[model samples]
Target: MAEDLSAEIGPDRSLLLVDDDEAFVKRLAKAMEKRGFLPETAESVAAGKAIAQSRPPAYAVVDLRLEDGNGLDVVEALRERRPDCRIVVLTGYGAIATAVAAVKIGATDYLSKPADANEVTNALLSRGELLPEPPENPMSADRVRWEHIQRVYEMCDRNVSETARRLNMHRRTLQRILAKRSPK
Candidate 1:
């Protein structure tokens, strides 16, 4: 379901964006502004917290890793200060463990980095809403890792050598990993 933010910010919203990546943050802030959000950028968790405390925003988008501290810390602080605000996390490596940890620590939602403007906006809009039921057992760590490897392999067009090179793994090791994941 889409978020009903009309009551919060009167059809226009303000946001706090926390990330150490200057380029990415700048680009995303501009994109969000075009989407009707006023985005305030912070390069670290401390700065993000300070900004939110001094001028509480309607929502927040935080990166998982920062130069000073983890984004989860910022999310926690935001939740404490503004219980009604939505918090979305961004992860670059897309680790399932980290995503789960973020959610446990008060993040409203999470999206892997390189996400486009639409994806980010949608995640923000749907924040704090119950997600659809996950598949049985869902995906485990090994399954996620295997899927990452498979995606990298396909991006390299199934060239094991290129895939391994891109992933910083030995060709033979990559072969072994893929072979081990093959069903009997």
Candidate 2:
């Protein structure tokens, strides 16, 4: 993280930090404040939405999963209310699915939890180049759907019938989709 980012963004840029974890929010807010941003903390999706709608912060740091709702909803709301504001999604271990969804829905970037202060700061500073335009994700929606199906397939131990049953799809339909996705 560049130490001069605070000077770059100046003291007027307001940052909205939304996470259900109290301790994490406190530490993150303090770190951001030191970098010259005015940090506001919210503990739930509802409160975060309310704060965002009312004040419209210049930037937002959101958690992927909230106690009340998924962070994607918050990202959508923020984008709707503040199109110019940048949003970074925070994810916990093994929540890449949620993080990817958040990015697809308009999160500027996604960072895994236990992220260092420098990591968070770097994410914020890099917003200038990363946001205002959506990032390219090679993982298409169809790819994600197939990946989910593959997980179920593996969990079912390669039992087509069981995998189809678990996914609430007919065996033939699953086979057809998988076949269509397979390389020639």
lDDT for each of the candidates?
Answer: 0.78, 0.76
lDDT of 1: 0.78
Candidate 2 on 53-114: residue-level lDDT in tens?
89888888998668897677788889998887778888563234445566777887788777
Give the per-residue Cα lDDT of candidate 2 at 75: 86
Model 2 local distance difference test score: 0.76
Q: Which candidate tops lDDT?
A: 1
Instruction: Report model 2's TM-score to 2 decimal places.
Output: 0.68
What TM-score do all the candidates reach, one by one? Answer: 0.66, 0.68
Per-residue lDDT for 12-106 in model 1, tens only? 48899999999999998888877778789999989999987888787899997789967888888888888877788996756555566678777
Task: In model 2, state the lDDT of residue 28.
Answer: 88
Error of 2 at 27 (Å): 0.7
- Give the clash count for each candidate: 0, 0
